[model samples]
Target: MQYYYGNQMPLRLLDEAEFWKHQEAEHTEVIREALNGLEPEYVQALKEWEQALTETHQQVVSYVETVNRMGYTFEELQEQVTELIKYCLDESLKFIDLCREIEANSAAAKDNPFAKTLLNHIIRESEYFVGIARIILYGHTPA
Candidate 1:
């Protein structure tokens, strides 16, 4: 997973608003592909969950944009992003579980690795984001 995304832009350099927009679009595409082989009816919950993710990403983007346009600091955006990371951390666990379930049920394509790859990426990325978010929002210290 690290090799896959190693050369990507460091999140620190990202314009939060633009980053969220790109991430949101990427997520939509990835999820669409991931659900490709699942039975249509079986994907309703997944579709709804994907939509909710989109909506949240949009909200975060909008908030960051507004903050950037004004002469304001990103303090609020930090809190918002922290919350988003927490939500994503939880969702990533569920996503991994659902993929495992689908694979166990033999509903997923055996030849296509797209869904499995996406879920693994989500899990690793979520863990990284959660760690970064925690460090930023509450400094990590040796306990």
Candidate 2:
């Protein structure tokens, strides 16, 4: 009774914190089982998505640190901050698009545990980036 891409599917088990905890776990058993009968292309796409997520996360962190220690005159810091904000916005948009793509491709599939996990990670990382971006853009820490 496993569902595929085009099949109607049941509501996912949604225990927000627990679901995220499961995703954060290094246990690959669920992913391995899910991928056991899938196509190589899906596997390859999943790897690419994971790499993109990691790279984006690193870039956001580096940008935030750089902006924090800019140590420049007002005008110079302003310009640099503008550029950093633009970069963050672009990265955020890209991250959101990737999440949407993953959700669309895997939502109906019962064997998409890996995709689900990756999506959850991407979402959490994206939110983190957004928070940092806001702090940089607004000069105010979130309350």
The numbered model that scores best in TM-score is 1
Count of steric clashes across candidates, in order: 0, 0
Task: For model 1, give the 10-residue run with minimal summed lDDT.
Answer: 1-10
Q: Between which residue pairs do clashes occur in model 1?
A: none
Output the TM-score of candidate 2: 0.44
Q: In model 2, which regions exceed 4 Å deviation?
A: 1-71, 106-110, 139-143
TM-scores for all candidates: the values are 0.57, 0.44
* Tens digit per residue, CA lDDT, model 1, 11-129: 34224333543454455456556656766644665566567666656665665556557634445355555666556545544555654555445356444576667655655654454
lDDT of each residue in 1-143, candidate 2, tens digit only: 12241211111111121232233222223333453553455556555645554454454455445534653344544564456455644556564564555456643334466666655665675565555555545655557
Please tell me which predicted candidate would have the highest lDDT against the true structure. Answer: 1
Stretches > 4 Å off in candidate 1: 1-25, 34-36, 74-85, 88-97, 103-106, 109-115, 141-143
